[model samples]
Target: MLLALAVVPAVVQEAVLVGIGFHGARGLAPQVTAVWPYDSYHDLRWLLIYHNSWWHFLFGLVALAVFRGLLSAGLTALAWPGQVPRPSFAWLLRRNLEVAALALVVISPWAALSVAFSAVALSLYLFASLIPMLVLAPFLQRAGVARTWWRGLPTIELLGWSVLNFAVLTIAGAVISSTSGWWGVLVAALAGVANGLLWRQTVTAAVLPARIRLARVPVAPVAIILTMAAAVAAQPILNLVTGPPQEWMPLVVTERLPDRVPHAVIVIAGHDSHWSGRQPADPRVERFSYQGLDRQGRPLPYRHTATHRSLDSSSVLLRAQVEALHRRTGRPVALIGSSEGAMVARTYLEKGPKPSPVEAVLLFSPLIQPGRAYYPPPGYSGWGVATGWELRGLFWLVGLGRADRSRPDEPFVRSVLVNAPFYRNRTLCPVAGVRMIAFLPTVSAAEAPPGEYSRIPVFQLPAFHGGLIGRRAAEERVVDFLAGGHVDQPRREYALLQRLGAAWQAPPLALVLNPVWAAEREADPAFTGRICEPR
Candidate 1:
């Protein structure tokens, strides 16, 4: 009954906002049409009036606060039951108004911030919000159902529960909205029901007796750890029995020469599924597959297993195959890898006890990073903050040799690869002797060591990630380099390379994207910064 009453105001406010928005749209249409002759004016008016209207912001904030308060009260009542008495209609209204005012004052200031700045705001808000809860948890339990005043409220616990509920609901809504048709609605409805049951279970657990709670405390973590271990232990058996899917099989293109020693190019594909089973079809260059397959000959997708272990195993297998091929055909081998594959190749070279059979190594779109700060892209700044926590959780799972197959697109593997400090250490850069060439696209160019190393040549490509994979010009350059020829292009044209020559060194990961660099440059005319300067 209390939940129903709380929801009534929210429903009414939503309906009123829809009506107002529709009326505003109708009134603005004529003005939009009148300004259509001037494209710039029309765009400006549309952006200002339709997209960034103050009225919309006000209405949205009120609606969000009302819904949040309603959900908060409902969950609190559910959790504490007899202890948390049902709020009166007047009490509910007061609480909603308080929440709405807080949202407007505290959150609205940071709403206009950029993605990265907004992430900072979100972290601050989450931390600030949790403090009150941690402090009030004991007080709320002590208060029981004694008073109906604001001073006696369990605002922190209520807000925390509501936030979790909101997250589940939001995810369901997103899935529904992103889907094509009525199936989405059905799925969302089922999700909603499941979420409600889950919420009930969560509340029950929260209110469990002291003895029961203590007894179950260690069970969950232990179970999770054990399950992950079992999964990792079982992977080899699964791989052997299932066989690699056909797509996972190495794609080999052979080039045989009559008299001279044949030259072999071993290509290691990246994380992208599109590159699976891809091979260079050049007659002069033989392409050998380094990625492993299951027993059934089906491809084991990169995301299907614990990547670090799988890649390590695959790297070992690759060396054995290359050695056998070198023995039989007397071929000189060249290793070429892209993205995650590049990281794997680098790992093999670094960890191997002896020098590999490969005569040269060419890395494209390598995943080497100085630290965690450089992992996320510009667009990932905001949501990446939250996803970082998820990555931490999955990192342990992967460390235990368990694969998180549920979310293939999640940057868990990338997170692991980027944070591996050994790979980023300049002192441990692949041992000398072998010819090494790094062809890095703009985004990943920072991964390469600054300046020229003895046998390592870092070439910057004026393109984004994955741009050099199949391009004819890029492929030709790679082939030429592998054949003991240097890249003919002017190296000075690349901004990153030029900066390296000008004493612009790669900064630590935390400072790489620091806004202070921009601020310092803006403040001083001749301030040449280490980070974010030209490069």
Candidate 2:
């Protein structure tokens, strides 16, 4: 309840502000501006300020319970004359000193959210909460009523839950223009409680028996240690089996825009974590920024102004390229985007004068939104989008592992790729009727907002092993764009499908510029020198 009292007000405040921003703003533009300025800070601060309140409250309640036990023993000693010498207060004090220290290590940072911590604090808060739930589950299960109650636990008793709800609604409101505030809050609350209970069970079952007194020559301490280690191991294993979901990460540049006009294509490189790599990858630049380098130069600590991948610096670099293209070629240039490069293209277009300055856009398995997926379906008929797993693999190949479980303090490497200085000075994209020729493994019209996108012609490519098998998609899309051929899907699909089915599916289609060769080294080092030539 104390946790609720402390956390709810802040949450309510943020959510209310977000709702006002949503409803009160003149339209999308002002709301977008307001949402970023206040909602983000408010959401983050809310997390930091209130993460530990419930844990603190729990500590007090437990300490009180221990005190009650000790006090009862003392009173019994006076009445019964002999009984167990009322266990020494000095001994109790000394033992509890260790307990208090441990508790502080566990709870204080949570309560204070000290040190401007991020994922770690949240993890600890979760860990401390989970321990007791597991220990008590059997009892609750036996109680039947308690088990049912726990499953659909009510909001009022849970600590910091309401606060979590409010924070989620505000943030969601900030990002998605049409989210329902009350529904968002309700979903957040339910999710938080359910997750909290799950965490509590996992942690308490692992720890308390070890740290506290245990009967029968217990090895609970060692067991607890092993449990924690196993939990850590479980994470990577889970990622592998479940095929870690795609997440947004920093964008990187593969090549610079041509100084001359009518450039053939804009190549943007994808990134990867290189967990298996030994040496660090060298840095390169694709944008103009605070650090002031147009080509590969050192970076500053400053963050990008727009989305993490859409860097101001890189956008500036692209803006310069765009201006030069119009001047030199006497005709607007065409853009070729791949992977995270698509975001660079999108941001460039968002700055306006695109499709005009650049007549058309050609994307190859583009990372339109960082880490989110565009999936392909179960059968050939289902071939309209790329599945979540393929995109995750694509990122892993680029050395920019999964975004969902990202380390909070990670520097914005991908973000730097698109951070062009010029983009900051420009307005967001409002250009109309510029052609967007999208070459995707699957182009799902369903995933797109009904009318959010304009005049974008998507070309669906063939799939193999439930994924985009080769360059057929890219080739056809480019060929059509350059040739000015209207897409004839029924005829094209029949021919492609027939050829793929014949000759035992024939040889794999070749690519003009295969991203796979670059991704190969990071994916598996044994072939690094063989395929990538050890660069």
TM-score of each: 0.39, 0.34
Clashes of each: 16, 48
Give the range of the ten consecutive residues with the poorest summed lDDT in model 1: 30-39
- Local accuracy of candidate 2 as per-residue lDDT tens digits, 346-420: 666765453346666655444321211011222321111121122233234333453434322223332321222
Q: State in Å the error of residue 463, model 1.
A: 1.9
Q: How well does candidate 2 match the true structure in TM-score terms?
A: 0.34
Model 1 per-residue lDDT at 275: 28
How far residue 277's Cα lies from its native spot in candidate 2, in Å, is: 22
After TM-score superposition, the amount by which residue 229's alpha carbon in candidate 2 deviates from its true location, in angstroms, is 9.0
Best by lDDT: 1
